[model samples]
Target chain A: MFDFFIHVASIACLYGVLALSLNLQAGFTGLVNFGLIALFGCGTYGAALASGMGWHPLLGLPAGIAMAALLGLFYARLGRKLSSDYWGIATLSIAEIIRISITNEQALTGGAQGISGLPLLFAGLKPYDGMARLALYVVVLALVWLFCQRLVKSAFGLSMKLMREEPQLARSLGYDLDRIRRVVMLVSSAIAAFAGFLYAHYLTFVGPDQLVSPETFLIWSMVIIGGVANNRGVIAGAFLMQFAMAYVPFIKDALELPTDFVAAARLIIVGGGLLAFLLWRPKGLFPEKVGGSNGR
Target chain B: MIEAKDIRAGYGDGADILTGISLSADRREIVTILGPNGCGKSTLLKTIAGYVRPRAGSITFGGTDVTAVPIHEKVRHHKVGYVPQTDNVFGTLTVAENILLGARQLAKTEKEKRFAALMDQYPALAGKKTRKASALSGGERQILSLARALIAGPEILLLDEPSAGLSPLMMHEVFDAIGAIRDSEGMCILMVEQNAFEALGIADRAYVLSLGQVAMTAKASDLLEDPAMRKLYLGGEVHAE
Candidate 1:
């Protein structure tokens, strides 16, 4: 049971990072990035390819982040022409294109077999190694949460909030809307890619299937339920989601349901919770606070 | 000085709302544009502010042809301050933050100095500096917008419909604040106003636009007394007191 909970806690930390990254783009900046999983896949593929070539995990991690950030910048430039509604579809389509290409390019990406035996981030441990690894993961998560907190309170963050609420107002006050949007995309993508690096190394494997729509939707649910622009809320949301995901299997066993039925039930439960939040508490558990003097 | 020469502009593919309109305002002068609804008065101000690009004409500010400069560049490089008729102050930002948005490029000491100076000029804002801009009354909001723009120390200020929706006494207070800004800063101001009598009262010069064309251009006092101008554009109401 200790092992099971440590595994769940480690996964929760990784998802918390993803949630915080997405919140920067979607919640603070009002960008709809439906293709976030595509960027995550890029990170996974980048780190896996590097590790497969015998590179250290630290070097591979940066490679993944850089690859994802380039894609994010490209999409941000394209965003200038596309409205929000269309941008969501465009991003979703791009994710599928990347996924399909990875599936077809068997030689380069190991094709459908996917990459295996990825270099472990924390390999070679002693007694209670699982708990130690989980503790380290929590530390990393705390650092990321602190970084996001500082960013959200800075002047750049204020400009981001302004861009979300009133682009015209932001532009009139000397903020270049295109530049701000592009920078934000790059930053968020870098953070998401880092989360992917951790996931690839922790699991010691990475497959294109992991970069599916459900993964992206799960992160969205966390952001929506925790609080849109609040970092603390996002972390809380991530842990709550992990708890739900773990407990559903226990329910399946207790009720003697089929394994396939549990998968469908998990989706229904997550979707229903999201709908309930939208209807009852659109602002999530913690709503965004106004910035600047009034914000204090 | 700021000048717009024969500017033709419209939204998207629509017909030109401003067809070859030319106007100018010099330093320390309050130039008012008075026109009926749909006469393109606001469009003229927008064109000068670089929010609306002129198709065939040019806008020169302080001897530079900034016809193609983006709105952000106009505010940062050209020192242009624009206050839209509505939604001028950010409701989510504090009153001080709204003012500081334009003053970001200044040094901390300079920014604080300007903030202090503005508080001195507008005593009402001094007390409400920590309050959200949304909490302000309509009249106070107009003053907040002016304070925000002036905090940037702009060389040219463009105002659209400053007295759109206000009681008569509030309107008087807003115009008084505008006149004070002009006298204190010695900056060029071009305003589009529907309150012709109140506008012309403080304006150094006034232009009456009819159907996207300049119908009359003269000293504010001259336009006030001109019977034909009053009959056509000034609602033929009470003369300037």
Candidate 2:
């Protein structure tokens, strides 16, 4: 049971990082970035490719971040020509194109066979055996959390909120909307890629299948159902949804229910939870506060 | 000094709103553009503020041709300040932060000094400095808009319907603030307003616009007393003395 709890907690932390990164663009900037999975996939692939080349795992982390940021810049350039539903469609198409490219690039990415035996982030430490490894993972998660918190409170963050609420107003006030948008996209993509690197290193393996459309949909649902604008709500939603998905089988086993039926039940619960969240608390657990005097 | 010569402009390729319009403003003068709705009053202000590019003609500020300048460059070079009619204040920013954003291009020490000076000049903003702009009353927001504009020490202040959608008391306060600025700061105040009588009453010179063209230009007091102007532009019934 203790091991189960640890596994669940670790997975939740991972998803929480992804959710926070998504919230930076979608929630704060009002960008409909359906291609977020592309950045995550890039991170996973970049890290895997770099580590597979026998480079230090730490080197792969920055490589993944840089590659994802470049992709984000590409997305931002594309986003400028579209907005709202049109932007959503454009991004979805871009994501599909990226996934197809990855799948087809057989030689470079090991094709659909995927990459395996990637080095662990802290190879010197034993897996799940010592407090050091657990502590390191926790520290990584904490650093990501701190970075996100700082970003949301910064001047750039406030500017992003302004752009989201009213682009015209933001422009009239002298903010260069296009430039800010690009910067935000790059930063969010880098963070997502960083999370991806962590994921690849932790698992020591990755594939095109891991970067599928379903993974993208799952992250989006986590962000939207959790409340796009609320960071805490996003983290809560990530953990709650991931844990529920992972733990339902245990419940089914205890009850002696069929495994297939239990899996279907989990999907239904998740779908129902998403529907309920949208209908009831559309703003999530912590709605953004409105109206206050300017900062000092 | 600021001047617009033969300035012809409109939205997109639409008909020119300010056709062959010519206007000038010097320091220490209050020039009000009085017109009915959709008469290009705001367009003229926007054109001068560099928000709109005139299709033909030139805008010279301080004897420099600034017709092709971007809005921010014009703001920096010509020291032009604009207070838009709507969403002038950032809803999420505190009033103080909104003001600071106005002075963002300034040095940190200079921005702090300007902030202090403006707060002192407009005492009403002192207590509400830390309040978010979205939470302010309409009048307070207008005051914040003015405060933000003035913090930059702009040579020319372009105000677009500063009193629009405000209560009578708020309108009076805005005009009073404008009057005080004119009396004390020697800032060039060029404004577009729908309130003809009230605008002309306080303005040094006023131009009446109709169909995006200038119909009349004269001393504010003269325009107010012109019976034909009163009948055609102002309401048919004049305010009793």
Candidate 3:
């Protein structure tokens, strides 16, 4: 049970980082990034490819970040020509393309089987590796939270909210929409890639299955159920959802239900939670602090 | 000073909305463009403000050819301020934050000073500096938009239908505020307005556009007194008071 809690906490921390990344782009910037998982896959693939080449998994860090940055830039370039809804579709298509390529590229990515046998992030610690990894995730999540908090509170953040809510108003005020999109995408993508890198090591595997559309929806649900633009709420939502997911099987067994019910339970939890929040509390657990003169 | 010569522009691949429009306004002057609906009034203001690149003409502002400068560049480096007809204020932000967004590029001290000055100039907004822009009434919102543009200390101001959707009383207040901007800041003001009488009352000159062309250009006072102007635009109702 102790081990299960650690696992849940670790996974929750990792997804929290992802939720924060999405919050910056989707929540604050009003960018609908349906390809957010593609950005994460960049890091996983980078690490897998590096390990496949007999290099240290650590080397994949920079490579993955760079790949995510380039992808983000491309996404921003695409956004210049497309509005938000169309851009969302475009991103989803690109992510699907990336997933298909991973599935079909047998030689490079081990095809559908994926690349396994990657070492744990703290494997050197043997019996203590789980705790160490969890500790590292906690520290990382804290740092990311602080960094994002600082970013959202800055003048740039105000402009981001402005652009999100009133794009023409922001443009008329001399904000370069393309530049803002690029900056936001680059930063969010890099953060997502880092989370992916951590996740790949945590699982010791890189697979196309990990880059599914449902994963993106999962994070979106967390953002929505927690709070759209509120980081603390998003992270809390991450933990709440993660814990609920990690224990669905336990609930199924304890209830003497068929194993198939676990999957249905998860769907109900995520979808029902999202629907509940959207209907009753659209702003989520901790609503974004806006308009207070003190917001500055 | 700002000028557009023989400007032709339209929305993406459409026929030119503005055809052969020539206009200019100097500092300390308000030049309002009055026209019937779909006469390309807003498009003309957009073109001069760099939102639309002129298809076949030149634009110069403050002695520089700004024909190709984008809207953001015009507002940032060239000290241009623009207020659109609708959705002018950032609805989710405080009045002070909305104003400060316009002054983001300024030095901190200068930004604060300009904000303070705007607060002084618009006391109605001063009490609600921390209030969200969405809470403002229509007249207050128009005033807030003006305050936002003014906070930037722009030299070239472009307004699209400044009096749209306002009560008659609020319309006059907005126009008066605009006239005050010209009187106090010495900025060149170019406005597109449906309220011809109220606009010409404060404007130094006026241009009446008809089907993408300037039908007439005259001194504001002259246009106000011209019987032809009344018959064409003002419903030919009461004589210009």
- The candidate that wins on TM-score is 3
TM-score of each prediction: 0.92, 0.84, 0.96
Q: List the candidate 3 regions with Cα displacement exceeding 4 Å.
A: A292-296, B238-241
Better of 1 and 3 by lDDT: 3
CA lDDT of each candidate?
0.86, 0.80, 0.90
Kindly report which residue stretches of model 1 are placed more than 4 angstroms away from their true locations once superposed. A126-129, A258-260, A293-296, B13-15, B210-216, B227-231, B237-241
Residue-level lDDT tens digits of model 2 in A1-296: 77667767776787888888888888888888887888887788888888778887678778888889888898888776676678877878888888887778887788778898887655676554434445665676678777776777777777788788777556555677778889988888988897788788767788888877667667777877777766777887788788888888888889998879776977676677767778997877666554332211
Reference-based lDDT, residue B27, model 2: 84
Candidate 1 on A1-296: residue-level lDDT in tens? 77898899999998999999999898888898888998888778888889788887678778898899899998898898788889888988888888888887877688777999987655677666777778888988998888888877888887888888877777788888888889889988988898888888888788888888878889999999998998888889999988888889899999999999878877986798689889999889988776673221
**lDDT of model 1 at position A277:** 89
Clashing pairs in 3: none
Q: What is the lDDT of candidate 2?
A: 0.80
Expressed as tens digits, the lDDT of each residue in B46-162 for candidate 1 is 888888888888899989999989888999999999888887788987888888888989999999999999999989989999898999988889989888888889989989899
CA lDDT for candidate 3? 0.90
Candidate 3 chain A minimal-lDDT segment of 10 residues? A287-296
Best by lDDT: 3
